[model samples]
Target: MSKKVIYGIFDDEEILLNSVKEVRSNGIVIKEVYSPFPIHGLDHVLGLKRTRLAIAAFIYGAIGCVTAIWLTYYIMILDWPMNIGGKPSFAYYLSMPAFVPVIFEMTVLFSAHLMVITYLFKCKLFPGQKSSSPDPRTTDDRFLIEIESDDEKKISSILNKTGVTEINVKEIS
Candidate 1:
């Protein structure tokens, strides 16, 4: 069935939070919430699952470290080895300390860049990506809660009682 969404626009974070709780407690399904700033405890109220970005970051960092080790070993110890500062160029263990900075920097670089890319991809955001927020005010000073249900009467009653300043109803494809 094509769903009709109701957006309860709120003027304050506290009111939005309270309204979310009230609506959900009454057996209504909230599709999404938009806010100008982060709302503390909102995730808990929404029952969102924990993110796995940390695990992905760790794997990216491991890959970077391994790449750094192989590149350093191949260049410094095998391919045209240089007698840098009169240090032994034949043994990688002897030049291990010199490669520590490179390894650390590569690890941080790979993790940060890859993690951000992954986040952007997961969110379906890229250059020139069109936004989906129905009201532009949700990105500025307002908080919006989108509710999905077939009962318009119940939805309006709940939203009106919960201090919603503006309400917009739309059937989106």
Candidate 2:
């Protein structure tokens, strides 16, 4: 099935922002907006919910911390029991200070790498994926707003008053 949508283009971020607000106020549902650079507060205006990536990062960090602690305990205390530098090898706590750096590094490494992977997966940005942008100019200096509406005349009238640079209609599946 294919749906017809209206695309409104703007040259300035400010104009796009204001136009978005006005369009929302008029009860038209905006499908998406594309811009070359992020415009602050656009997400808030779009009424998007906060992300849970931070929670995922914390969980990944905890996993790394636990893995590092287990590895250090198994290697230095249980398996080899090294007596290097005359450090106490009798108890894990006695040798914990030496393991602090490794633990911290592991935690940071897991959090950073896992978070990036999670983000890429969440965004569906796989290799060889085609772009979803409606207009090429939106990748440079233009802002494009997509609204799904079968009623073109009504949407065009509302968008025209918003001072759009150009308008185009497209059908998508």
For candidate 2, report its TM-score.
0.93
For this target, which candidate reaches the highest lDDT against the unseen true structure? Answer: 2
Name the candidate that leads on TM-score: 2
Candidate 1: clashing pairs of residues = none
Per-residue lDDT, model 2, residue 164, is 92
RMSD of 1: 1.7
For model 2, residues 24-43, the per-residue Cα lDDT tens digits are 99898999999999899999
- Which stretch of 10 consecutive residues in model 1 shows the poorest summed lDDT? 82-91
User: Which sections of candidate 2 miss by over 4 Å?
Assistant: 1-3
Estimate the TM-score of every prediction: 0.93, 0.93
Clashes of 1: 0
Clashes of 2: 0
